[model samples]
Target: MSTSTAGRPYALIAEFETPASTLHAAELIRDAGYKRWDVHTPFPIHGLDGAMGLRNSKVGWFTFLGGTTGFSLGMLMIWWMGKVDYAIPVGGKPLFSPIFAFPVSYELTILLGAFGTLFGMFFLNRLPRHYHPLLKHPRFRNVTHDRIYVVIECADPKFSDAETRKLLEHAGGRHIEIVED
Candidate 1:
């Protein structure tokens, strides 16, 4: 395994030939007390998230909060404009009508909810990442074609170069590379 001049590892990446092998490797890694690990595959593999011990995403909460905020603001705007700010009496109608405010509130809710979902995904996923350590590996180039990769970062407390390589090999991984930072 390669290491930096300061004796710090960069990352350990393992290559698998099939999605099933990758899934098995992820499960092994998850159970091995390593926290900083990730899997990459050409296509989505069933049960991979569970194997990786990942929980549901938080983007839905962001969307719900944003929609609620938009709804509240829309209602406040309509009520204030119609009743307190400029109570323009139009054809003997009620100043603060729920029927009239419903459309604006609904539209604003949808708009803000969509924006929240989009931005939430971007933020949660750490988008706009210009470079990644895996991107520098030559075998990683086949990830988009028909390869699966499981990478364990050196930052994990349980990360030991010898043990990690052995674990990956036991989990049916091949072409293991000690990626450099």
Candidate 2:
């Protein structure tokens, strides 16, 4: 085992058969005063978000901000370039012809919203962290199949390996393992 996991003291790996069981395990673990834990599943389970105690994602807000910024900038650019800089008099339209700028603004809004959501999610989650001790565990490959796994890192202040194992066993997790970091 790598020394990176040595400092954690201990860690518990629990395998659950169903999404419902995984959700229940998470709730029980949280009630048991363990906070540093995560759930892995093949696909997103309905209502699992609430069970895991995750807050609403702020990516929507980021997308909205990006789209608004894009719309404003697009309008400004079109107005300055078409009306002020070039001064094109097409169909006797007004200098600040918003109708002509609608398409550009719309396109910019979509582009910004898509990119902003992608980058915002990555930023908020602090992702691209390819190396994790959990990835070293043998059973982790089952995550893509029929299994759901919950891992409680020992780095959490309120963890005792034996007690945590018992807690997981009681929570209906099967094939529980002690993972070394």
Candidate 3:
């Protein structure tokens, strides 16, 4: 139930050269009933979603909520300003014409959506984090380069060093290293 930095005494890094291999390794680990794992790649892989067992990110929901809020606010502002606060007759038009507010409403939708998406991503991923346990491993720089690596944290309830290493090796991992905290 609790994960302490010092309590994380073990980790395993399985390095891969190609996205295909990385996907295969991820599938194998997932099928083995290992829950606490993450994979890294140099670029996006087409079917990696299935392999990684990742669901759709919640960023879309955040953006939708934000856009709705923005639209509501925009409509409220226009209604209050033009219809209630100061009603001005122009070209014999109604006070609350939807056509007149299209531009502002559209802009607000996009504005809020963008802001919400950015903030949501940061919040969900726990960004502004200056340091990470992954950074403690030396070979992990390959994540931004050509190599793909999968790591299973020792803190998982089902994690075991011997079993994880054997599974990775059986999955054709050529370079496997232990990550120390």
lDDT of each: 0.87, 0.84, 0.84
Candidate 3: segments with Cα more than 4 A from true spot: 1-10
TM-score of 2: 0.89
Score residue 119 of candidate 3 by CA lDDT: 95
The stretch of ten residues in a row with the least summed lDDT in candidate 1 is 1-10
User: What tens-digit string does per-residue lDDT give for candidate 1 at 128-176?
Assistant: 6767667777889999998888899888889988999999999998888
Expressed as tens digits, the lDDT of each residue in 14-79 for candidate 2 is 899987788888888777777788888899898877787888989998899889988998999999
Q: Give candidate 3's error at residue 150 in angstroms.
A: 0.6
TM-score per model over all chains: 0.89, 0.89, 0.89
Q: Which pairs clash (backbone N, Cα, C closer than 3 Å) in model 3?
A: none
Question: For model 1, what is the C-alpha lDDT against the true structure?
Answer: 0.87
Model 1 quality (TM-score): 0.89
lDDT of 3 by residue, 1-181 (tens): 2343663566788888888788888899888888888887889888888887889888998899889988888888998899999998888889997787878988999999999999999999888776677776779987898888888888777788899889988887867887866
Q: Lowest summed lDDT over 10 consecutive residues: which window, candidate 3?
A: 1-10
Q: What are the runs in model 2 whose C-alpha is more than 4 Å off? A: 1-10
